[model samples]
Structures are given as structure tokens and as C-alpha cells.
Target: MSFGDIRVAERADWLIERVATAGTLVLRKLGETRAGEKSVHRFLSSPYVSVERIVETLAARTALQCTGRRILAIQDTSEINFAGRDKKRRGFGPAGDGKTPGFFIHPVIAIDVESEAVVGLVDAEIWTRAAGRVTSRRSRAIEDKESARWLSGCQAAASVLSDAAEVTMVADRESDIYLLFARKPERLNLIVRAGQDRSLADEGLLSMALAGAQPLRSSVVRVAPRGPGDKGREAIVELRAGTVRLVRPATVRKSEAPEDVELTLVEAREVNTPPGKTPLLWRLLTTHSVTCAAEAENIVQLYRLRWRIEQVFRALKSDGLALDDSQVIDAERMFNLTAIALAGAIRTIQLVDARDGGPRPASDVIDANFTVALERLSKKLEGKTLRQKNPHPLGSLAFVAWIAARLGGWNCYYKPPGPKTMRDGWNRLAATLEGYALATQHENPGIP
Candidate 1:
């Protein structure tokens, strides 16, 4: 809907408040208060209430937070599988099982490189594949393809973060497109995993070039457990760095021909993997120069922060937002709901990330009532021992997080709580605040 419409603005504000307060609950539950069920439905069904507008608003807020900082625009794609619904459902395509129907979402999230805090979502695109559509990869232009999302994401990030000191476009192997590198903006740099064994300027493949480089450094890195079947472990990894010039692929048309792109490649391989454990191997390509082991390690660390986007996806999925469980059938309505959910997911991560470090004020994220409720909760959650008491300054994000973590059952001895724990804590705290608000309203009937 157009921003000029007062109804659209009112609905947008309501949706944002609902998302921030209630989180991933179904619409009936979210709008159960003042607006009622019909209002919620009308809000979602409104043509002026759009996914792009919602995303743009949130992205602008994110960009404001990123002022004067070196931000990492971490981009990645995840499928929203709505498989097993009624076969007559209209707006979906082949998903996980190929027979099931769903769509894909590609998002670029800006992160503070120094603090590793999730700044905000820079941009997001949602689309479904055309039914019965198939095109030869070599013949189609990049502009007409889905893979162009990577380049577009980079461009969007560059534009949004123009005032920042620097913007590094970080991605996984899936984003290692030749055109992305050749046409990358001067203001933007890249740190993507190498997916192709391309021909180098010195007549050698990328893999061979990396394999020939001598190890420059060694360090131990923690590897998070991937699944229930595996255990988290630490491994000693060796780093190697090299520079290579990537040649243009023959598949790219003459008119679209791009100059050879020179990139610094760094490989981090585990020196000794435990029995039954897979060794860590990451070959990273970057436009940033790496002359020393410290510089290479910095690049590796930046790439590691790419996991933040994965956390966002997890927040949107079953573990957090439960987006796949959404009952919306129409594509437009679903996209609008997903946009709201996306904003909620980012806020969830922001709270979790703000727990330990950073000087962000709690008021910037949490409402005064929520913060007051958490403040009341802090006294009860803290222990007699000084160390067990809330260590963060009052009115700070860390202070609220500390209380939430305690309410979520963190004993203060284990590692800091992740997003799931914080989510549980926030849900409980929200319920408490709701009850408190009701009691306050009853005590003073005429209060506005």
C-alpha cells in the first residue's frame, strides 16, 4: 500500500508492534487484543500493505544503525517450504522434495564487523519458480536468472550502506558468480567461498594455486555441532594465502564480457581431525588484500560471521518464528506476513547478540514497560553472590538480556544463552508483562 494512505500507515504500525511484542504467534493470537481477528485479516489482505515497503522501512532503520561503521552485508538464500498443503494451492513451486511446493527468500543482513552484532536486514527478495519452466544455464543471460539475486544483493547493500566507511559483501559458495566479481562496485569488496576451480592467470586452477601455497599460520578454532548426531569440538587449523586472476568463462556472452578479476584466496584446513570427524576445509576468495597471517585470519573470522544469517533463517523457521507453520494460502498475503516475521526474527537476533557486549541502550530495542518488567525480574533472578547479580549497567541492552537469560533458566555457570533461550525468556517475560498491564488497567479504570 502507498505510504501516503493513513490506513496503510496505521496497519503497518500495528503489524510492527504485534511482531515485536507477540513474535511468531499466529495472526489470531497476535491480533486478539484491541484490533480483533477481522482487523488482522483486513490488514494482511490490504493491497497497500506490501512486503517491499515493510522491508524497506526495516532496512532503513538498519542502515541508520550502521552509520560510520565497517559493515558486512552477509547474503544467503533459504527456501520456505510449504510442502504437503492441499494440491489446489495457487502460488508455489517445486521445493525440497521437488514434488512439494514452496518459494525462496534471499536476504542481505548488515553486521558490525568489529562487534559481530546483527545491525539489521539490508534487503530481501522473495520469489517462486515458474511451473514447468526449464532453461539451459549456459544460454540464458544472468539478468534473466535467479542467480542474479547475489549481484543485486551486493548492489542494494552498497547503495544502502553508502555512508559507511566500508562494505564487504560476504557470502557462501553459492554466491561465487563470475559476473558478481567482474562487476563488483569499487566501494564494495567481496569475501565469498570459492565454488569453481577456475583457470588462473598463471595457467593453474584455483585449487592448485591454494594447494601450492605454504602454511602461514596455525590456530585452534571452535566448530559448532551441526546436528544431534554430532558433538561440538575444537580443531587446530592451518592457514594458507595466495592471489589469483580469474578468467572470464566462455559461457558469458561477448557483450557481457567482463575483465579478469584479481582476488586473494585463503584456505583454512584442519591439521588433525579426530576419528569419525570430518576435517574443516574452507577456501575463501576476497577482493581484500592479505599480506600476513593476521590479515588472512581476519578474513576467515569475517567469513565466520556469515553464520549470523543462518541464525536469522533459523529464527524464521521451526525453532523460532515457525514460518513454515503459517496458514496463509495466497502468495501476496504470505509475503506480507513473512516480511513482518522477518523483522521479528531480526529483532530476536539483535536481542541475543546484544547480551554480552556493545553499549546499545535497552530503550532502543525494548519498550519502557517491557524494560520495567525486566527490571523487576532482575532482582528476583539475581543471586546473593555479587558475581551472580546483573553485571551490566542499567538501561542497557545487556542488562535486559541478562535478566531474560536468567528467567530462561541460565544458571550463570554455562555458556551464554543463544537465540532460542532468549526467545523462550522473552515469551515468558511478555506474558508476565501482559498480566501486569491488565492488573494496572483494572486498578485505574479511566487511565488512557
Candidate 2:
């Protein structure tokens, strides 16, 4: 089940072709296409799709492909914002900040952390709304940016992921409520982070039982505040071993007031903060029975993998695809655009894994190989005179040739080192080395 062996050099090409056709097209058209950053934006957005699918597929495939190891299904969601001038602005309302306009894209992504690959993506719908008082479901849906759509999306993902074996749903505090937990349609497991005001009388009793058996010790870990606006505030909380029931704050519904639910709390935190700061510690609840400290730690770590979704966000933006700068108008177009960007982020993960080396072959290696081939071709035919005309022999055009030449097994001749040529030559040499590695993978697929 490990990525230790498996030659997918051929598969790399297939993935790359997919990215080129669907993934890249959506990213470039999303936004900033007219700014001459089309290529840059395209590159940034192509990886999300590949990575998400790869991780999900790998996790499912591994469970089926391997007999001993079980697959862990991880699901989490985050918000994607849009600007006023964005094409989707008409669809977007005030995004809580009042100054900016945006809509949210909620992706309930499932990944196999053990294998470090994305298994499935739930990039269907998003729900967004501005903060206000007297929120009702009908009124909220009207004002809701994308929540109804997001709900449907989450429901569909639940149906699809119900089939995953040994699947565990790990999410942040937002998903720790009854709406998501109480009615799981599939054979799914959940371990959600608890909210501060969650009613935990039952959990408190159980915690007291466990606490009576063993002494509670204080452990401190510093955590940075959540959200985009909050900066530089770090909270150091004292951790104690205890249990608490998780309850969602009740929404006033006509004649009905509110209700609470019970969940096991294993470890509770007592936050130390200055005045005006809210005290919070996770009233963690899980379907899986946590017996020992190690088991509790495992659950905590699994929840931590929720952060991988953030990495997925970065891959959508800083890595190569800028999801924030999207220009797609209308909700449907924006969703499609987001899907494409997700695909791009997935592809980026594959690219990194391929170059860094993983179980399956990545197109990045092929890219590296082709790049070297063109450099060699430029050297043989154009020679030193070409270098004089364009000192950077491996210009963008040469890179394309390098890809073709390496695939064709063209050899690169060594150019005599000159003072001005060393840096670029060294770079080319590195490219050649990468090309050689890639070519070797194709030539001897089983060697790894």
C-alpha cells in the first residue's frame, strides 16, 4: 500500500494530458486571463483537481488493492472569497467584512492521509451569507450566498463516501454540530471538534469518572487565531484530561426554542486569555471509542490532517493557480471555475510527487525529460553561435524542444564552461539530470 514501488510513467502522460485539456482551460478563463498572467494562473490552478482525485482514488484503491491496511477517509470544508469586480460579483453579496463582496465554495474533500493522496472531491455547491440577526432557513436561503447548494453538495458527498471502508469523517468545529453528525446516511464515522458553548453535562460526568482514576496534568500549546483578519494573537491553553457532550447553539424556530445532544469528551482544554478574549478548548467527540492516550492522540492527529485542505487552498492560489482572482460570473460558472481550479491543485500535487518521486509516475518527470531533450537539440544543431544569439540557450522555446528531444533519446553535449555560462549551464545541467531520471523511469519502469 506504500508508494515504495509502482512505475506509472505511462500514467503520468495521461494525467498531464487531462490537465492540459480541462484543468488549464478553466483556470486561464477564470480571471486574470487578460492580465498576461494567463499562463501563470493556469499553472497555479491545474493541480487541485489532480491532487484531490489522486488522494481519494489512492485511498479507496489502497483499501481494495491491499489486504492488510485500512483506509481512513478525511473530510473538511473551507471558504473561498470573491472580490467586488470579480465576474461572480452579481452572485456574491457582502462577505461579512462589509467592504468586500464574495461567495463561498465549500469542498468536502476526502483523502487518504496514510497514502498521502486525495481520494474524492465534493466540489458541488457552496453556501454563503452575510452575518445578520433573525436568520431563518427560508430567509437565510434567500440571503444565503451558497449554503443550500453547499448542503446538497455535502449530502451527495455523504452518499458517495458511505461506501468507503473504515471511513472516518474529521472536521473542524463548524461541522461538529447535529445537522452534520446526527443523520449520517452512510456507513460513515465522524470525529468532529467541539464548540465552546456546546452542552456537555454527560461528557463532564464521564470526564469526572476518568479524571477520578488518574490525575489531570496541565499541558500548554500555543495556537494562532483563526480567520483571515485576526493576526498576531496567539492563545496558550492549559490542557486537562476530561470529557464533555457537544451541543450546537439552538436557533429560534417559531414556537420552538433549542435543543442539545450528547457526545463523549475525552480531553478538554482550559484556555488562558486576556479580557475580551473567549476561552475555548475542543470538546472532542468521536464514534470510535478512544481507550488509551495514544488512541486519543491518533484522533487528534487525524483531525490535524484537516489542515491539508488549507494546503489545497495554497495550491489553488500561491502554488500556481490563483483561485481568488477568478473572473467567472454567475453561480454555475463560478462553481465550474472552482472545479477546474480544484483539478489544477490536484495536478500540482501529482507534479510535485512525480518530481520528488512517488508510487505512480507523474507528468512532471516527463516534462523534465522533454526539457533536457530540447536543450540537447539546441546544443547539437544551433551550437555555440546560438548561445551567443540567445545566451539563455534553454529559453522557453528550447524547453519545449528539450521535452521532445529527451523523449527521442537525444544526447546533450557538454559545452565548455565559461565564466558567464556557469550559472545557466549549471541550471541546464540540473535540468538534464532531472531529464535523465525521468527517462530512466520510462525506460525501466520497474527499476524503482
Candidate 3:
């Protein structure tokens, strides 16, 4: 949290201060003075402000926010590609595209399942593959591959949310690793989309386990778009759930691996195709017990929440921060900037989510000192009638959002404010807080 030194702390604070506003990640643009710009560059290049330190700071916040909540620890990996800039960049390796030069980010974000609001970040692993031909998977162990992050993600959620009432780690297909399920802590639960047609102890394929299972229920699901600009479609899918014992593969190098691991399988298969559109089918495997239709539906609902990370990714790239537009070419500095940009993107999404009037507290996103000031600002925005007043409780995140939407010029008559409006309002609110702090410091000397 100290960032190793007073100067380092100051520099890191400055970066977080402006980045949290959901603005651009450009250093000079974000800086108030020439020295502030240089400070940001130095902070990213400093060995003290490493990725581990920043993640630790985020995890500490997560631990405090996650207490007594049922958590959906959503884990995901995204690639940051710098294809044509390979010549100018240093200390970099191949991206997922293999030909391009870039790196990968695997993040685990915590969400309170009951309130369905983001709690905080549990962990993030940032790394790159060495340049050259990759080794064959058949000859390598799980620890020697990028897939190890899945296991580490589980470990992180366990340690960070030790006091949480319940923890269920959710992931997409890439996390369907046998070792992960076998070695997962007993205290932690798992829900990963099945990618492999793994063998079963019953001498059957995992893909066939639910083929003949009776339909427990049906529901409509939103299908994601095929491309960047296209709107997604909706589909009606039938749900089915069953249990199976997965047999460990012969190629598994872990001698301690169990012969079989029991897990529940939940399937949501599309009922009918609308023509030309892709069908919606999800084969989810989990450690949570499923005995009824309502219980199986809960699993499907939680797995759908994985899309929240995709929204953060969109905000981090094309929609909000545009991290690729940054001019920093050095790989080390880029990595640090990536970490800051990610925090900014996630916070931006949190504020946008708050705009809809959730039950989340104001302190979830703002400092306690700012709440009193926010209350004062809230009063100034109210109109004559009670209908014009903010409907949310005084200390909630929705209260802050109402103030922000008002600052962004929302009439409170149309549909709720969008992300751009929320971002504009949030920045305005942040600038007002800065002005308030400066004004009060002269009188109280150290009040903030």
C-alpha cells in the first residue's frame, strides 16, 4: 500500500487518482504539469511499483469488501497485441496470435452474488511467452504452461476471501484443466465451461453425459454478437444437469492426481435455430451440488455473469481507455501502464453499473472523507418537489451516481444515463472533490 517509498507512493497515487476517473490512460494528457507527466513515466518505470505491489493493494481492498458475501470469483484471460510495433518494442514476446508481439492478462474479479455488484479484484497474472517455437503440450507439465494461472487464481481467491461466506470460482472453457479440478481446495467451489470431451470413470465420454438427460427447465439467454459492431440475438434454451466422475488422463504428470473426480454437469442447449445465426449451447461443469431445477438454474445464472469481465475488457480497449493508443513502447513500462489502465477500466464499469441505482455503498468506490462532501453536493442538485429528490439512501453508490448523472446533465426523465454520460459525470465529480479538498486544506490544514 505504501508503494515502497514516499515519492513512489505519491506517483502511484497520482496515477490512480486520474485513472480512476475512467478517462484516457495517456500520461501527459492525464498530468497537470510537465513534472506530473515525468512522474507518471518514472512511476511506471520504477522497480518498486511492480505489478505484484499494485495487485496486493487491490487484493487488500477486495478482502475488506468481500467479507460475509457469496462470491462469484470470475477469472478470464485477454491478449494485448502490438502486431506491427514488434520492431520498436523491447523485452516482449509472441502474443496469442503467435506472429504478433504482445502479452496476456489473466484477471480474477470478485462479485457479490447476492447484490450482483462488483466487490473488488482478487488477482491478476500478467506475462508473455518466450520468442521461438513453443514446446509440445504432451511433454510439458501443467506448472510449465500458461494454464497454471487457473490454479493460482483459485489459491488467490481462497486466501483473499478467507472470511467470505461462500466462494465459487467461475471461468470459461480454457479453465477445463484436470489438474485444477483435482487439486482445488475443498473449501473453494468451481464452475468452468467444459471444453474437452474428457473420459469418464464409467468408460463414457463427458460430451455424452447429458445427451439423454431429461430437461429440468427452460429459459431465454442472450447470445453474444459474432463481431464487434453487430447486436447479439436471444435464444430459448432447455436446461439439463447430471453428475459424472472424470477420469484422470494417462498423460497427466502429477503422480498425486486422483483416479477420478466427481462433478455436476449443467447443459443449456438451444431449442431451435432461427437460421444463419449460431446456436447457443453451454456445457458447464461444477463442484456445487445440483439436485433440483432451481439449483441447476442458479448455476447457469452465475456462469452467465462471466460476461461482466468481457464488458471490462471492452472498456479497457475499444470503448473506454484505448490502451493500445498509448505511445509507451518499452515493455516494462507498458506492463505497468496496463495494470493501471485495468484498474481504471474496472472502476469505470463499477460507476456505470452504479448508475442504475444498485444497493452498493458509496464507500465501495469513494473514500470515506468524500462521502460528507458528496452529501453536500447531493443537496445542491435537488429540485423543489420530493419527486425531484434522489430516491436512493444517502450513503449508497446509487446516491453518488444520481449526483454524477445530474452533473452530466441527465434530466432524470428519460432512460438512465449511459456509460459515456456516467464517465463524464464521474470526472466532473472528481474534479469538484479536488477543488473541495484544496479549499478546505487551507482552513483545517490536514482535514482530508
Candidate 4:
């Protein structure tokens, strides 16, 4: 059924509200009552609920958020592993281990490039690989292969964000496909980490061609802590950039002819490393011009924002949603639920990121009733000192965020609240709102 259908629209609205009030918990835990549980199950099982339609609606909202702004369409893939628990489960494929059952989800998220605020999701695809379906990459067309997800994601984002003044597709090494560069749209630009060292037009390797250029500039960047027991450090890296024409590979689809593609290569290599740290080296291929060191650094800064999608994944799985613990056995139902969870995760990130600097209205991200409740709670949470007072304007996103952070145990002394803090705050707020509704109903029983 279309989104316009009454039943479909009502179910969609109900699911979104439930997910927002209570983060992506299991179906049984998500529903507050027996009737609510049954309704959610029926909605998920209905033929009218579709993952594509849900994603399209969210993408349309994201496009509206991107009006009159430049956005970075970041793409990445993460595996949803349900293998260890469900050996006999149908409609699944191999995961990290060949014997485990799981599927892959790739999503494209739009973020404001300058402010680094997450706008929303543009599109997403979920699929499973069939067992014993190996094929020769050399003989098959690009469209017939699984690697084509990269190109398809880019095309979808381009269409959805057509009104955006500028859209840059940011990806990691897995997106370094030769055919992708050949067929990329003119309006969509790419900045992908180089994965392969291919031959250049002048009979030199890509690495060798880049090595000839002298260092144009050096800059210092702060590297985030990697894992447990590691502290963050500042790194000094030298930058080098050059333009080259890549030679086409000998192996291609029979119908396709070889053509050279012109690209600008930017390399950032750490000059010095500490005692036990590994030096950072990144070779980036891009269509954007890098005429000066400032331009090259801008590309480097854009590439760094790729980690924003990683945060989105964290919000979906362990930090916020706990999606892996879901008990749904049906693949179709799980896919639909995953889409709703994804939208919830984006909302959480948007709130956390807008805590300090984003100047948007609170009504833009949250409801009026919720904001009113938060305002009442903020007075009790804030201290008498100015530093403890709300620094954001009333009715702004940062204002609500400050109230949530305080509820989550933030003392306004350390760094702003993270995803985990926001999750805790959201749970408390939802419960508080529920209590208020109950009290109001008891006080005015005949008003309704």
C-alpha cells in the first residue's frame, strides 16, 4: 500500500512515536500494553509496510533540512549479525564467519558540511548474500555485482538532495571502484580513500606519480583515541597533491570501451610518530580541484567527517538502540523495524550534536509538549551560578539538550553529553511525560 493509505499512514505514525518515546527496544518491551504489542506485530506483518517507502519519506524530510545549505552525503556499510543464535533461521546469509547467518546494511546520511550537524538519512539498502553464489568479477557487468551498492547509493542521494546547493559523496576504500568514477553524475562529486595503486597514463604507478610532488604544506591535527588504554594525541602531517589521468584496466564488460579518467590525488602522511603509535597515511582520490594547500586541506577536513556515520552505527547497535538483541525472526519484519530504528538513531545524534552550537528552534527537532515539560524541569536542574545556567536561548534545540544532559547526570563541567547520556535522558523524559499525562487525566476525567 502507498504511504497515502489510511491504515499504512496510521501504523507508520504510531511506530515513529513509539520508537521516539522509547529507544529501539524489543517489540515486547516497546509496547506499553497487550493491545499495543499486538498492534505493532500486525503492522510489521502487514503487506502495506515497506522499508523503501519509509526510507523515501525520511529522505524527503532530509532534503527539506538541506534547503539552502551544502551537505556531505556520507556512505558506509555495517553487518547485522544474528548468526550465533539462529542457525536454522531462513532468509539469511553468511556473516563475518562463513558459518554465521547475517545481512549487510548500507546507508547514506546527509550532514551539514560546515556545522557537522547530522541532517538525516537519504537512502538505505539491506540485503543478504545467497549461499554458493560465487561469480567471476572479471566476466560479470558492474551492475550485476554486489559492489554496485556504492554507485546506487550515490545516485539515490543525488536524486533525493537535488535541491541542495552542493552534495559531496564521501566514502572509504571499499568505494574505490573504477567504473563508479567512469559513470558518476556531474552534479555529484566524490572523495574516496584510495584502495588500489593503479597504472597512470604515463606508464607510472599511482604511488610513484604522487611521490614526485614536493610537500605543499604541513598541518597539525588531533587524533582521537583509538581503543581502551590509548590516549588522544596531536599529529603533524605533510600534505602533497597532484593531478593524473588513470589508464583503463584491460578487463571490462564486452560492451564497455576503455577510457581514461582525470582525477586529483591528495596524500596526507604523518611525519613523526610516538614510541608505539603507527604513522597515519591517507591517499585520497577526488574530482574536486585542489589548486592550493588550503583547497587540499579542505578536502582532508571533509574526509575526516566520514567518521560521523560510524557514530550513527554506534547509536543503532550498542550505545543507544541495542538492535542486536531484537527477537524478531522474520527477515521482512526485521528490515522494517531496522528502518524505524535508523531514523530514531539519527534523531538522537542530531540532538547530541546540536547541544553546543546549532541555532535551530527546539520545535524543529522535538514536540511542543515535550519542550514545555523540559522547560519546567530545567529550572530544578540548573544551579544558581551563571556557568550552571542554560547557555542556549529559550525554545532552541540546545536549550532542551541542556535539560536532557542534566537529567542524564551531566554537571555542565565536563564535555557535552554523548549518545549514551542522551539515551538515558530520553528514557527519563519519556517516563516523566507519561506520568504527567496520567496525572492530568485523573485531574480532569470528564474534559475528554
Deviation from native of the Cα of residue 434 in model 1, angstroms:
6.2
Best by TM-score: 3
Find the 10 residues in a row with the least total lDDT in model 2.
Answer: 417-426
> In what order do the candidates fall by lDDT, top score first?
3, 1, 4, 2
- Cα error, residue 171 of model 4, in Å, equals 0.2
* TM per candidate: 0.91, 0.55, 0.94, 0.92
Q: What is the TM-score of candidate 1?
A: 0.91
Per-residue lDDT tens digits for candidate 1, residues 1-448, read 2466788777776666566556664888777766566787887888677878877887888888888999999999999887666355578777756667887889999998888888888999988787785889887889989899999999999999998889999999999899999889889999999998888878888888877678999977777667545557887899999888988888886568565778899998998799988899889999999999999998888888887898888888877888887877877788888887888888888889877857777876766655555677788888988869999987888888887677677888768887777776776776676677777776644422
Model 4 earns a TM-score of: 0.92
Better of 2 and 4 by lDDT: 4
Report residue 44 deviation for candidate 2 (angstroms): 19
Looking at candidate 4, the ten consecutive residues that score lowest on lDDT are 439-448
Distance from true position, residue 274, model 2, in Å?
A: 17
Cα lDDT computed for each candidate against the true fold: 0.82, 0.46, 0.84, 0.81
Tens-place lDDT per residue, model 4, 1-448, is 2476788777776677567557775787677788888888988877777889889888988898888789999999998888557755667777656667777789999989878888899999987777775788887888888889999998998899999999999999999888878878888999999999988889998888777788989977666666545557878889899998877888765356357889999998899787888998889999999999998888888988888898888888876787776787778888888888888888788779877857667876666655556677888888988879988877888888887777778888867787778766766766776676677766645322
Error of 1 at 207 (Å): 0.6
Q: Which residue pairs in candidate 3 collide?
A: none
The RMSD of every model to the true structure, in order and in angstroms, is 3.1, 11.8, 2.1, 2.9
